[model samples]
Target: MSHSRVNNQPAGQHGMVVAPGGGGNRNAQNMPVDADGRDWSNGLCGCCSSCGTCICATVLPCVVYGKNKHRYQHLDQQGTPEPSPGCCSGSCVAHGIFAACGLGFIFQMVNRGHVRHRYNIKGSGCGDCCTSFWCSPCQLVQESREIELEEQSFGTGRY
Candidate 1:
């Protein structure tokens, strides 16, 4: 690997040593090294998860992985047919969001319980732009407010 600064400076100019490797001896000038002896690539550095693909590596951390993992788990529970014990947690909401986002159905069965009803009510207005189903109640309130505003405007002959 060829080491260079984020600004594209050669590693040697920044006191970086050439590791004993056949690949290009590249080291980022300002990045921290990790416990595994791998340089902590900057946020812009492209690295793949264990799945061997980096397509969504950066965006997935915040929106698809970590805390979002719970979302996936949630959808899987709600969407599955056979009720798995693991699905009872909040993971179903996350899973449903992930599934709705085109991640595919991880859940074994689809359970259209009150949870799904709430999701349907919320998703109807914005086509499911909201990521978490838990926000359905809030969405309903917002929808009502919007309706009230529309009615008031119409009544005032403002179209």
Candidate 2:
């Protein structure tokens, strides 16, 4: 009687291609892929690890948020310093005006959505709404770190 062994090798480890007719890994298929294939950074607490950023976030949260917004939107130039992250970016005048009117939070929300889209991060850890409402500073910190991470990882220089 002829005997045959089952192909029990681990997927993607047996020199198997990832295309059709090759070993398929559901886990690998589900991994998020940015333009440069770098994973997104950690959460808001990551800012604390950086002394300067933590201080900035605690002191002038609005300004930090503005920069984070500009970075996330991928605007060019050393854009004007904004008091807030505007609906769009790179315009400090509009940012100042919008912030004074208490509309900066809304602008921040929009940018937060953009960050999520770019990094493919799913909303979790008490949901986006609760996080933004209860701990806006944390959200700002997280976004800032993500922008920094995106730039450092992908060399986008957006931040």
Candidate 3:
């Protein structure tokens, strides 16, 4: 019972210890969006709107998706770094570029979710999964257009 009181502070070597189990940035700001809050085009509406992308999506979906996906990852990379590795995994340009290996939709689907969050698009995880699963190309086109529109309005000049 003769112990001396110690300072109530973390060890100096610990630096800044980020809390585990979701205490950091819950809202991802990697990709900025405009305050306009415009509604997005339907996933199936790419044909009449963006015939070029629609045709490319139909003819060479792999090429179109590969380029776009890689570009998406790069956009995120140029922004604020994620708090943790698991915060975002599909931000690899190389991997996204090779997203034509049939299993790439999994990664693109995840990326789509991030885009939705960035643009404040109202939707459920199940909805994103279904859109990505059914018409991945259309999803890509919609995402690309959304990004372009946001960049144009916000004038981020990053993309």
Ranking by lDDT: 3, 2, 1
Cα distance off (Å), candidate 3, residue 29: 20
Which wins on lDDT, candidate 1 or candidate 3?
A: 3
In model 3, the Cα lDDT at residue 44 comes to 55
> What's the TM-score of every candidate structure?
0.18, 0.53, 0.53
Question: Compared to the true structure, candidate 3 yields what TM-score?
Answer: 0.53
Instruction: Compare the candidates by lDDT and give the number of the best one.
Output: 3
Q: In candidate 3, residue 102 scores what lDDT?
A: 56
* Poorly placed runs, candidate 2 (over 4 Å): 1-40, 75-103, 124-126, 155-159
Residues 53-103 of candidate 2 have per-residue lDDT tens digits of: 677656656666767766544422332222234543354345456767766
Candidate 2 — worst ten consecutive residues by lDDT sum? 20-29
Q: Which regions in candidate 3 have their CA more than 4 angstroms from the true location? A: 1-38, 41-43, 79-102, 154-159
| Displacement of the residue 149 alpha carbon in candidate 1, Å | 0.7
TM-score attained by model 2: 0.53
Q: In model 3, how large is the Cα lDDT of residue 29?
A: 35
- Judged by TM-score relative to the true structure, which candidate is superior, 1 or 2? 2
Q: Please give, for residues 32-128, the per-residue lDDT of candidate 1 as tens digits.
A: 4333232222221222222222333222322223222333233334432212223233454565466567542222112212222322222221233
